[model samples]
Target: MAAVSATVILLIGVGVPVSIVAPVPQARAEVAQEQQRATDPAAIRLPSFGSSAVGVVGMPGVLAKRGPQAPRQMASITKVITMLVVLEKRPLAAGEDGPTITLGQRDVGYLDQVIAANGSWQPVQAGWRVSQRAAIETTMIPSANNYAETLAVWAYGSVPAYLDAARAFLKANGLDDTTVVDTNGLSSGDRSTPTDLVDLGRIALANPVLAATVRMATADEPNVGALENTNQLLGTDGIDGLKTGTYDTGANLLFSATRRVGDRTVRIVGVVLGARDHPTLDARVPAVVDSVVAGYHDLALAKPGQVFATYETRWGGVGRAVAAKAVSRVVWSRARVVRKASVDPITGGRKGERVGEVTYSVDGSTVVVPLVLDRDVLAAPVWWRLTHPLR
Candidate 1:
């Protein structure tokens, strides 16, 4: 017989009692990351010319930029900003001609300055009565330099005041790289980059009055007998209303277009500067637009029945938590897809019960998915209930 320590308690009953506790189950979850697609800048052929710049921006931050940040002479593109600033201060109501302005000798005097300086002009007569709408068309469409100056002086009471307002407008809109000394963009002093112009182009398109006026090939006004749009590319390849500029420095064009991607229309804006001539500048407009629109495609992030988590028990029972269905999203090139998952600590769950959740995010957009059990995870069996470790 073995000797027993006095400190050790011995059970003298016919059957020694045993206490067993059911095992706890641990949750399991993992992120299944999807491979991201690639976008080659060279895939979209851009124009190679003297100091040219280009950029594209769309919904959900689909942005790609190229070319130098240097400020080039904006030429007539300055008129685009002139119109925008005017609209911001004096918004025209739908089907309304806006407030009336009687043309003074000064407005006509400015027309004489255009003639002496050899700037483009629409026929203007002193004491001519006109609505604000006609002046907007007379400013944007024919690229009329005198009407531009007239409209500016009318809006701000002086050319210096208008320039001050233009600078303030540029600063408020985050166009730090742009500066304007004139509303007509005739002077080499007016400067901006393709990136800034692209932003300005979008702002112009948002205004229905400005957008509609630019789309017209020609407009017959009471003061100006006939006015023709300088943008020949208007209404071509989804190209609509925009501004065109030509100067001793270089030619400039700010273009806006919309293309259908799946069930959505992706609005695009292209800015090209420093081309050889107007036709050469016009040719690259569609290329800049097509390159951006072609990058759209629907992407799949997750599939149905994909296991995202699991439930395991010490008693040898397990169940998988899976995605109930597939997930897809509309994305542009170089967009990223990321996932996060969490599982609840469940001792047991019936088949198809929810255990936790998973979230997928990309480009400031997110989608949540539920994690359901693939099979039932029952409590410990009778044998396990009797044979588990005693506590």
Candidate 2:
């Protein structure tokens, strides 16, 4: 009788706890996958003339390129650099016109100077007072060469000083292929490759002042009245604010557009340099944009209530870990997608309890989906706990 009593105590002390509190079986994950597919670059409609490049905003590297990679004449697009450099010294906030400039004789002389040079010009009168925003508006909206120089002189006190600052800005931004010789691109000295121009376009779109100003179809200036925007592509297919350039070499356009891929909005930046004419540049730009947009698509990674892992216990309890909801991601055509699963050990749990997660990643973007039990995992029976001492 004493031996029986001792056995009972030992069983209660060790067997009961081992069965009730010992670690349960870990869930094993099983994943289903589909082969990844790549987009063909040959399918993209790249410009046949000059140099061109396109890239999605926030992603590194150029998505597509054509023509020679060497730097080419960029024409009026040089105004973009001037605007950025000047604004760096004189920052303009959204909805604010910034400081005012009083037009003097020398400022008025800019009209004749640019006119004689055969560059674009907007009318300015001596003693006319213009706000900083108005000056920028006059400079960019009409691609005015005179105001570009005027703003450059006003911001830096001389064209030479502005040139020094512009060079520094280019270097600091890693635009080694670009060179700025003047505030307006009228000088053959202003040159940049399609890749550098694409990066420059990205920078311009990042600035609130420039981004807002470039989208206007027309802006009313204090002295110049209403000036029309040179970028005729604005407002078409979501093409927004950006700069344009025309020179003896060829016409160039640094453009930005937006499109919807899956549930995400994607901004695209592109540049076409050394086009034969403005008409050719305009027609080619939209085609390039559409082709780039076509390269992005939504990939289905997982579906709702699909089993990813299974849980089996020594006590005969069973459960399945399933995705709680559907998961999908938007990715470029060449980007590769990968999946991983993680699960935790569990003895038993109520239905719909979260147990694990699955992650899908592509090109630095990631999506995580929760895994839950599809059925209840009941507690082990008392008989099993008492009989199985070491489990």
Candidate 3:
């Protein structure tokens, strides 16, 4: 009877081993699924575009687009590129004197035609040479066609040369579908999509000088009388001067605005094309700007030190465990989906110990990557160590 009793006890102890199980909470699983869905780019329904348009509200990659791939005549917005190319290749120092620009016969001819058409002009008289500074200011503030042509000639020695340089600049900046037939957006042939124009605006905003000039509501030049920016958005709280383009075929505008939301500074770039007229543009651009502002939010899907799971260490003594935090906080569009994640332990882990890991499915296959301990794990407490030292 004693032997049978001992056998039964042994069987029972062997049948049920002492173990620790940490199950993920229902809320956590839901959060993970939500995050996964948000990170998947295919799930998002980005705005559609007729020719290519892109709008970036703030960081965290909240990119909205309409006709983001379609090409359209950019008009004066092309001057954004003209200004960028000049700044990149031949930068002028702040407070430095302007460079002398000799007015050539071709420049004079172009100026005459622009003035005759009553197009935006800098009052550039024939044989009246102007400083490079004057030409740039005129081009930017009033969207002067002659000023752009003059600057193009000064920079590249001729209109054709300037166009080649502009084309090269566009190609280098991933504006493959864009083309520039002229430095000034006067020609309808010089076309780009709203997507490309947004990119150009971002590039221009990076330059302190260019950004400052664009923000100015009015500027004076030797050749051109006081010029006011055609951009109506300028000086309208949160609206900075970008550029406006108009022609018989289409009217377009590219605007970059900055506003403080809580402790963060949010920058919004808006592009509108094919508006019927100035009034239409005025009505539409502000709405787009407001949309971007309303959509902007601090993506709080992930938090610092938030633990996704807790796992026991295989090699460590009893009561030893590890906690894993979500990877970097991700802020992406709604449709983006996160297929998988990885964990990197910061401290206290033994070799082969389950410090952390990520389990996810991708394309119908489960993939796992182990997160090893970043720091060495000390032995268990002295009291526990005495009884549970490395077996």
Candidate 4:
């Protein structure tokens, strides 16, 4: 009987079940996925530009969806980088003269063919010479490939050397995604992104000489009859200068505009790559600029503690009091507002005393400042109040 009882007890203990740990609930899994989607690059719907699009308003705001990662064949827009590289390495002072380039037999032959094919020409005769300024004007204004090649050869002593410099410049400027097979942007394989072009535009505008060249309506080359700027926005209100590019792949435009708002002057740069046609870009570019301006206008700078009408706190001896003034100022984007509150101890705050902190969030960024007790609370006590307290 004793053996039987021991065996039964052992069987009962051995058969007892272990508690199973439950898996995370399905709802929690769904929540986690939603959070991931918010930050996932693949999940977001970026705007579709055949190449790319980037528009910056003011100093720190980009109003457009920077598109997907893809290789794009940028046409003449490649010249923007060519110009940038040249300016950085060889800065020309105002009215500084450039080395005169006399046409080689090969250059002369090419110029004649290009001039006959299209009225656009750097117009170099075998013996004719030109200035760097004239060459730059032709290259930037009319997207002249002849002048681009000529300048490349003159500056670096060979077209290959000039191309090496161009690629090096692009890589140094955070335009790693770009590839330049040629200096003139004549090759369809020469590619870049709208993001890259916007950066190029920003760099180009920093050079006063380059800026002036792009803004000219027409320039006369020593031997080249005349070169006219193809960018129509030069004379337009609020638009000064920029470059334009087009090829069978698509049309690209880099537009820089300046507008005065009150005492502040704002410069905006817009890049649109791979439009169906020139007309489409002509309409879309201005709309993008208008959107950026509108978005910036809606942004506001808030005084600290504006999120709460009043904050009330208790004092052990003085009873309840409302904070008199807000803590600090906050600048926020036009998007939704988020507020957070905390407390700090000031000079007068006893243990556990409440000084205040208010945080305001704008466009995913936050600014936090302090709030202090009103001055009236610190005023001297009144003698009449001490004597008449009973009443």
Q: Please provide, for model 3 over 329-352, each residue's C-alpha lDDT reduced to its tens digit, 9 standing for 90 to 100.
A: 223233232444444432234544
Q: Order the candidates by TM-score, highest first — what do you get? A: 2, 1, 4, 3
Residue-by-residue lDDT tens digits, candidate 4, 285-350? 665555554444323334432432232222212211223244332222244556555544221323
Write down the TM-score for model 3. 0.65
Among the numbered candidates, top lDDT falls to 2
- Expressed as tens digits, the lDDT of each residue in 250-309 for candidate 2 is 788899998898888999999888888888889888888888888887777789998878
Q: In TM-score terms, which candidate is top?
A: 2
Candidate 4 matches the true fold with a TM-score of 0.65
Candidate 1, 1-391: lDDT as tens digits: 2446322445312112342343433434344444344432334556777444444444422255556658888888999889888877788987789999898889879889888877788877777899999999998889999889988888888999998999999999899999999879878889988778878877787788988887888999986788889999987888876888888656778777777776667777767788779888887778777877677666666677888766667777778888877777767766766778777777778888887777877766888888888888976665665554351
If scored against the real structure, what TM-score would every candidate get?
Answer: 0.75, 0.88, 0.65, 0.65
Which sections of candidate 3 miss by over 4 Å?
1-52, 57-62, 67-69, 95-97, 102-106, 126-129, 261-263, 300-332, 335-391
Task: Sort every candidate by lDDT, greatest first.
Answer: 2, 1, 3, 4
- State the RMSD for candidate 4: 17.1
lDDT of 2 at 238: 77
lDDT of 1: 0.77
Model 4, residue 268: what's the lDDT? 68
Candidate 2: TM-score?
0.88
